[model samples]
Every structure is written in structure tokens, then in C-alpha cells.
Target: MENKTRPEGFEQIFFADGNNLAKAHPVKQDIAKLKIALRQLHHNADLLIDAFIQRCESENVPVDCHMGCQWCCNQAVFASTHEMVVLVDYLERRFSPEVIAEVKEKARLKEEKLTELSPKEVLNTSLPCPLLRKGTCMVYPVRPMGCRIYLSSSEKSCHAKYDNPEDPTVIPKLFDFTLKAGRQLNEGFAASMRDEGLDMKEHRIEHILLKLLESPDKKNEWLQGATIHDNFPFDEV
Candidate 1:
């Protein structure tokens, strides 16, 4: 997918009125539409990655990441609430109550553990994703854009950074095309919400997860921009 054109009315969606934020109360159907649009954007990303992968293979470049290889999950998985809604909605339908409880507990613990660290510090730390089990992501269907674009050609480089993450230089080879597209769509959603006066800010997925887990009603408050993660311990969003 070369992405020569935006999805239909993407311009209208993105360029909606920012001053009219009071109008951004996205209903269930609107949110569903947003999720579908995101999925479409991700599909375009997949096409780009597939083509990129083929070219890399022609050049003898190997992407070491495969099923059951999830060392990257140990690092931070930050995302906008817009992106994360996909994960949470999917989990609610497919995950059992037991799994939901476990995930909540995990998010709470992670929130508590990382409360003292700044966002930058937290990024350098290795904390297993609460949704990763054994070596698989339970919510892979809705993994964030960051996860989608990150691919390692060398496991040694991944493990080295995993072991000593403070170095910051040891990172995987990420595709710019996918990252750019994902951000365009994700931030576009933010702008759409902001146009309606919604909370257009992004946050670490874990922090928002903790809030939603504690109170299901928080989602409405968050979308309305009436409450930030004031209850959240991390000062750095």
C-alpha cells in the first residue's frame, strides 16, 4: 500500500474544529468507527512491512522476531488511549473474568512499582507486559503501533539492551513507514477528539489501564478531559 490517499474523509476528521472540543463526546458507534479506521491504517502498515521484509530478505537481512519470541514485551509499551481502546475492547470480549482480574492485578502492581520513576527512567527498565504469558502476547491482536513497527534483526542486540537498557543505543531496527502511519492515524484520532474538546493527550498504557481497571467509569471522564491521571502516581505522562 503506497498510501497515496487518506481514507475517504480523513482530512475532514483530522481538520475538524479544535475549538469545538465540547462536541467530541464520541459515542459507542463513533468509537467503533475509529477502531475500524485504526485497523485499516494498521493493515496498510502491514503491507509496507511485508514489502520491506521481502526486500530485506533479498539483501540477507533477517528479522529475528517470531512467534514465542517476546523479549521486547519486557520493555515499556506506551500508547495513546485511542490506540489502547482497541486492546481493552478486544480483551473485554475475548478474555475470561479470571484473566481480566489477573491483568488488573498486574497493572496495579506495575503502576505501584514504577511510581517513583520518571517516564524516561521507566522506559529504560525491563518490566514484563502484564498481558504476555510464557512468551506470547495475549493481546497481540491489538498491540500498539510501537510494537507493530519494532523488529529485531539480531537477538543479541535485543538481549543486550534488555540486560542493560540504560545504554539507550542498543535498540531494534524499526521501520519508519509503519511508525509514521501509525502515529498519523493515532494522533489523528487525538485531534478528532480534541476537535470535540475531548482529552487529546496520550499516556502510558499501563497508567490508563490501572485507572480503567479501578473504575470502569473513568473512561467517560477521560474522554471528556474532565480528569487526567491525577490519581495516577506517575507525574510524567
Candidate 2:
């Protein structure tokens, strides 16, 4: 996840002059309420973020990120067990069998390659995401929380950091409160799932995909508290 600080006057940045605040309503009580709430919260936050960015651009502080920019796609990305449901569901319903086969191999190869690298080497590793097709996210709508909030105002900085992953100074601006709120909402989702006896541990993209590819029922089993697999999702690298 993106580690960033709220810029000075953070509240103002998010809710500047003339920006109307959003109100929330209670959810209908149901077994899948948490998942529903998670989607609602994410959707609402996405709106605020989109509005905020629009206003920022009006003031000449436009974000350099545009569609089809895949500089950040070539790196390590993670998703929680809670978010994996969204991913797996999308793949099963939307992608064809041939597409699924190709992505499974791509994800498995990434996992194997990263496992052999040292910590430093892994940090500098660059691999196209299995879901990335020609520089666009195939599952953009159902992308994880981490992917949703990873915004930047500088494309040059993105390139710099992606090229020299070891550099501390070459960085991009990320909204701290945006990331924090999204994570807290996700935490609630995970907590709810755990209460329902689900495995809510975070996992790397490839590891989770490989397991799901092997067994289609893994999600259903894990949701019911089944210890079907080992605890470690990412290797000890």
C-alpha cells in the first residue's frame, strides 16, 4: 500500500471551499452486509477523490497521471483476502477460458521469479501485472483498495521510483487520509469476514491467483473457516 502523509491543510485539500459533504445511510441487515458496505464506502470515497482531483486540476495542480499509464503496473502489488473475492468473481464471470489460462501462467511465473530474488532484488523487480492488457487494467472496476487510491501528481517521479526502486527521494504524492479511510473501511470488512469465520489475511496478487486457479472452491472453503492451505501466502522473501 502507498505510505504517504496528509499534506498541509489536509481537510481543506479534500473538502475545499464550495465542495458539498456526502451523507451516509444505514445498510439493510443481511449476511453479506459487510461486503455491501465495503463496496458502498469504496464507491463513495472514489467519488470524493475524483471530485477533489478535479478541483485540484482547476487550480493548476493537475495530476500527471492519465489513462493507459502503466509505469506503476510493473511492481509488487498486494490485496487482502477480502478484496480477492472481488477479483476472483470478476475473472470467473468476465474472462474467457483462454484468457484465464494465459493470466494464470503469467501470475505463476511472476510468483516463481519473485521467490528466487533477494529482498533488495524483489524491491527492484518489474513485472507486468497478469491482469494488465496493453497498459490498461482489465479488471479496473474491481481493482483492490490499494490500486484504487494509488494516485500521483507526477509521472516523472513515478518513472523515477519505478526505475530506481531503492531511491528514497524520488517519490510521488499520495493523500494520507484517502488511504487511511479506505484501509479502515477494508479493516471493517475483514473483521466482519473473520467474525463469519473467513480467512482475511492479505496476500500477494500471484499467490492468491495460483491457488484459486488450482481449486475453484478455495474461496468458499476459506470463507467457512476451512484450513485448506498454509498460512503464508507470499513466500518468506
Candidate 3:
């Protein structure tokens, strides 16, 4: 479906922002600059999403998502390599060593479990994200676009889906326009990275995070045009 509620000229905005991001990091060594550029893109996307939420409220359209509402967390999360790098950087700077170690263990276990499941089984299973803690997301601020854009219009519907994930009859009422716009913007950013000769493949969050945490230098290697996590199984969200 198309983004009916997207702001006018959003396509142009996406193109320009993507090109600017590519320009911001001219060389492979500009990893820091790339992070900054990605952050700016995220910031801008948040503002746009907030505005859309407000518009929905003004129109009497209920948005059931809020802090501490995490029924949707018990599902697969796919993210780009760049997003994983930013998250790894955040974990290193903000979390204590103990917490990082715990996170790594959680990710490792989750990855192992996922590897044993078939793609269909993985989709039907309910597995909490490693970053989730006490009914909240530990990395909400720097979460991937996939997590950022998933919004439900009914809390009860979310609960129904969460409780009966394998029930094809149950479905959450989501904000389609928000998802579409957010995904388009993320694709624009990813396209920019690809244009810069970087591998912009998306992977299952747990698998990619485990690899990145185990070998911190993999981030630099990836930045230098080397591919990592190529063997990890992934499914598009």
C-alpha cells in the first residue's frame, strides 16, 4: 500500500537526504562521520513520525503505542548493518561491562535458537528481543527503523496478536502510512551507503549483534568494504 498520509514531496526529501548522507561520508575511514549522518537521518525521521502521530490524534485516530507497551517486542527484528554498528557503539559507551556481557549472552542464545528454527517457524514463534528489559526496550532511542516504525492502533489488538501469534486470524491494527514512510526513508539511507560501496545487507538483529560484539573489528572491516554475517540466515520484514 502507498503512504497516503506522507508529507508532500517526501520522495524528493528522501532522495536529497540519501545523497547528503552519502556525501557526508566520502571515504571508508569516515565511520564516525557516517554515524553522525545516520543519527541526523534518524532525528529527522523521528520528527516526521511525531508530526504524523500528532496528525492522527488531531483526526481522532487512536495510536495505541506508548512507552512500556511492548507486546510487539516478541517478534523477529531485522536491521541493516549500519544500524547494528550504531547500536554496538551505543552499548559500548552507555552500558557497563557486566550489562554488555549479559546482552551478548542473550544475543548468543537467541541466535542459536533462531538457527534451529525454520523460517516459517521463526515467524510464528514469539521470542523477546535481547534489548528488552522489564517490559521496556533498553535501546529505544537508537532502535532500528523497523522498531521505530511499528505502531498499532489498538492495544487490545496487539495483545491478541501477541498472545496468539500462531493464529492467522488474529492481526494487529497498524499504522500503514507510518510503516511505509519510515521504511522508505531507511531504504534511502541504505541506498546512500550502498552507493558509497558499502555492504548494506539487512540481517536478523540477534545474529548480527552477536557477530559484531564478538569481533568489534568487524565493524571497521565492514566499513573497509569487507562483508560480514554473509552466512547468517535472514528474512525481510
Maximum-lDDT candidate: 3
Q: List ranges where model 2 is wrong by over 4 Å.
A: 1-38, 118-121, 227-237
Clashing pairs in model 2?
none
Candidates' TM-scores? 0.77, 0.77, 0.89
True-structure RMSD for candidate 3: 4.1
**lDDT per residue, candidate 3, 86-184, as tens digits?**
888888889898998998999999989988878766777778899987887788778988898898999999889889888889988998877767777
Lowest-lDDT window of 10 residues in candidate 3? 1-10
Q: After superposition, how far is residue 84 of candidate 3 from its true place, in Å?
A: 0.4
Q: Candidate 3: deviation at residue 35, Å?
A: 1.6
Q: What tens-digit string does per-residue lDDT give for candidate 1 at 63-131? A: 777887777888877676666666777777898989899998988888788777876788888888888
Task: Pull out the clashing pairs in model 1.
Answer: 21-196, 21-197, 24-196
What overall lDDT, based on C-alpha atoms, would model 2 receive against the true structure? 0.65
lDDT of 2 by residue, 1-237 (tens): 112232234443432211221113222223254345556656866886788788887898857778988888887777776566657777878989999998899988998997787755765777878889877888887788778777777888778888877676766666565565555555544444554555567656776777887788876666566644333433444
